[model samples]
Target: MTDENGWDMSASAWVIAQGENGDFTRQFVLDPVIDAWLAGRSFASALDVGCGEGRFCRRLKARHGIVAVTGIDPTEPLLATARAKDPAGDYRLASAENLPFEDHRFDLTVSYLTLIDIPDIERAIAEMARVTAPGGTLLIANLNPFITASGGTAWVKDDSGAKRFVKVDRYLQEHSDWQAWRGIRILNHHRPLSRYMTLLLAAGLRLTRFDEPPAIGGPTEARAAYNRVPYAHVMEWTKA
Candidate 1:
């Protein structure tokens, strides 16, 4: 019924297909975020925003049995794939800016490498805190837009399976809002971790810790690879 609707469907399908073989996207930067998650003491319920194809959902489900993991995304095919892969997983096809749940419905909110791709990140962050009960944690693994390594954009590989890549500057353009295109294109807003901290704090959250994942992929053949991890930031905060 809207522009985002179709785009969401396409985005979801693209991710589902990407994960059909293996979780290509999540693998790119799972370590830094997972470490933060494992550090959490507990949670009664969890919500994952921009939950692309349930990569983080599966991990959450396995870590916390029947923890009432709810994944919300605007992509239909991605939700379907997530639903099919984890039959018991709960999902809602909705935009990140507007979630379809009552306030304080979740004990925790987890988003991985999702903030940068989202056009309305401020609204999304607000919605995340809204769904989280006070004192609950919000763990986000947003793009350090300034990371020198590389984004998870796909690349070609060598005959020997060595990984190589290109920056893929125009990757998120079609998916972003025209007004926000400048920021996304140039990664101007998503710069240093301090910026994210300011945004999170403005949303009425308290910053906890930050982590950057180490790059440990290849050095043998040199070919197209995926999600070159130059650097990333892992954030932990509480809804205050």
Candidate 2:
């Protein structure tokens, strides 16, 4: 691996996993909620933190009509892939804890499924807030705290090989765990929901909306499994 996070080494696998459509949670669960949140909204400039392969950055322009979109990631391989895919797009190699743009540069700043990947959650949240213009929104999509707290032991199955119930422990504890699947290995951090809320509020962001969205489309089995536990959530915070 080229980096400690393993994302540099797993970049290709990550891209493959997110093929034309995103993985199950993104396509069926998170996308619908994000679409609804962005309905009738328009932005002149947007920043996507931890934008692997620039998928959401493209979605901002192609689907939502955002004029200028800049994506940043710490992994160079992913940024290279994103740049190759969208030559005209701005994909920078940068970390969320230290954004390279001027203060209050973007009207819409987003962190989609990325908070878990950041080692310094407080610093990352502060940097994200710093770059967001006044009256702008910071949209976040993330795995639920319960789900992350499970730390890869998310389900307990019976002898019949059926899921009995989700398993969550140490809900209030903050930690990191290694996740390996589909040729991708990476570290994911887990923090209590209150940790995230406290950081956002401390950054002077007002919570505008929050939702534990249900899956709208995917394989029947996967959709059913997701709805049972609702593994992800979305939040919208605004800078007043």
Give lDDT tens digits, candidate 1, residues 1-240: 455424443554456445543333345445535644566466678888978688677777675553788998776767887898888889888877999999988878888767765667678788888888998889887655543222334344679865554444443232332222211222222334555567789888998877666543433222122234344567789887
Pick the lDDT winner: 2
What TM-score fits each model? 0.70, 0.98
Residue by residue across 135-233, what tens digits does model 2's lDDT show?
Answer: 999999999999899898899999998999998899999999999999999999999999999999999999999999999888999989988999899
Pairs that collide, model 1: 149-230, 156-224, 163-223, 164-223, 164-224, 164-225
Candidate 1 wrong stretches, greater than 4 Å: 1-13, 16-25, 32-36, 147-195, 216-229
> lDDT per prediction?
0.64, 0.94
Candidate with top TM-score is: 2
Each prediction's total of clashing residue pairs, residues at least 3 apart in sequence or on different chains, is 6, 0
Worst 10 residues of 2 by lDDT: 1-10
Reference-based lDDT, residue 53, model 2: 91
